[model samples]
Target: MNGAKVDVRKVAGEGVTWTLLATLYLRAWESRLPEPILGDRYAAGAVERIDYDFAALRRRIRPASNQFLVALRARQLDDWSRAFLARHPNAVVLQLGCGMDSRMLRLDPLGKLRWFDVDVPHVIELRRRIYPERGRYTMVGASVTDDGWLEAIPADRPVLVVAEGVLPYLTADEVRTLLARLTGHFTAGGELVFDASAPWVARVAEDFRWAPRDAREIERWIPGLTCADATPFTTHHRRIPVRRYRALYRLIHAVPALRNAYREFRFTF
Candidate 1:
């Protein structure tokens, strides 16, 4: 198969695929920046594999600090995953809502670590075709809410679950149900890292007022789950390559309400 050509039909979607493209664009944009916070080599490669007019789409969108924010979140998430991998070399890493990004490949969780990327069937099908798979890395085609898919992972090793930019789309009840199943399945206890929006942000952005009010709101839903750490969107603002944007983010962070606007949480069970 030609490396430059990908089936346009497969990548067509208004939800996950668009988000995936946005993430890839952020990585590509960051890589070209004077001083990139996260130099994701795989992102450029991923973007090439998808058949779309990325430049046109990117230009059409508002040129805000979105790319900066996206890169910051990815850096933070990748850092957390790396930290976990360093501590638990043989951990089971589950990437829920795994889209077009090559996180498993980028992280390179080599050796005893078992890595699984699970998402809806269509996305998984496209991902499997685009991304390379190996003995340690596997792709599952199932919704994260399904219980049967959880059985495919070994029960022996501790699991490190990552769901980047996923939880907000789900209803609060759905999020709680998924967490309950995960905690129940991983009785040995492990870390679950994911992002969530504040109630105000959700209301304004999605016209949904049910976003978690705080990190504690998430911990309360799952038994024996403690939010080990929570970092707001501006936590890694200093990492932004542009000086003015970095200063603006610092100012935003100083505001109490805006500081807690959107946060990523790391939970330990």
Candidate 2:
């Protein structure tokens, strides 16, 4: 990975697309720390090269408050992805709403597994400018909700669908339809990993559309879907650098409802 040639502000602009930059910035900031969670050097390098109003964006989003938390979430997802690849070396991976995440780079060093990073056209274009194209790696420039993108991916192999900070932005119907399409298309059976907020959190965050109190609730929406694991950030509260945030997470983890309010979930079908 090298420095970005295009200006992210001109490409991604604001709104949902801009959130990708925020995450990239957070990962880069975390990587600079003495002890980092994700240790994404590619993200740090991209951040340094991309020309954008990062300071203004930071002030607007106030992303620093959840900096470590963001890195933790990414690290957890990466771990799950690595485990999936370890078990099924030839599995196909679909990284939905990939943004500018370097997950494929981090996990697929040997380029053994087929990997596809799915996102909108503009984001994909930006990614092209930043990252080098490699064998067994393809960038799909299409919305996750779009059906056409799936046609290009091979359905013969088991699929591992990974979505981080994506499902919340999609409507419940959209998510259900997308999952149904995926499960129906891939008969080999695979896993789905993503994070979701609680209903109350969704209500508070006006932009978010879908929230499930329980991961198993998804099984009702899509037949054959089983909740394998649901873990809250508080599960690793000890890793938090700030004492106050650690204490807060501890309290949140104590309550079943609160703990599940915001967490990552793994589902198998």
* Top-TM-score candidate index: 2
In candidate 2, what residue range of length 10 has the lowest lDDT sum?
9-18
lDDT of each: 0.79, 0.84
> What shift in Å separates residue 55 of candidate 1 from its native position after superposition?
2.9
| Candidate 1 displacement at residue 19 in angstroms | 1.5
What are the models' TM-scores?
A: 0.92, 0.93
Native-referenced Cα lDDT, model 1: 0.79
Per-candidate count of clashing residue pairs (backbone under 3 Å): 0, 0
Clashing pairs in 2: none
Q: What is the lDDT of candidate 2?
A: 0.84
Q: Pick out the ten consecutive residues of candidate 1 with the lowest summed lDDT.
A: 8-17
The model with the greatest lDDT is 2
RMSD (Å) per prediction: 2.2, 2.0
Query: Once superposed on the true structure, which residue ranges of model 2 sit more than 4 Å away at CA?
Result: 1-5, 12-16
Q: How do the residues 50-150 of candidate 2 rate in per-residue lDDT, one tens digit apiece?
A: 88888898887665566777887888888888898889988999999988899988998777778998988878888887776799999998889887889
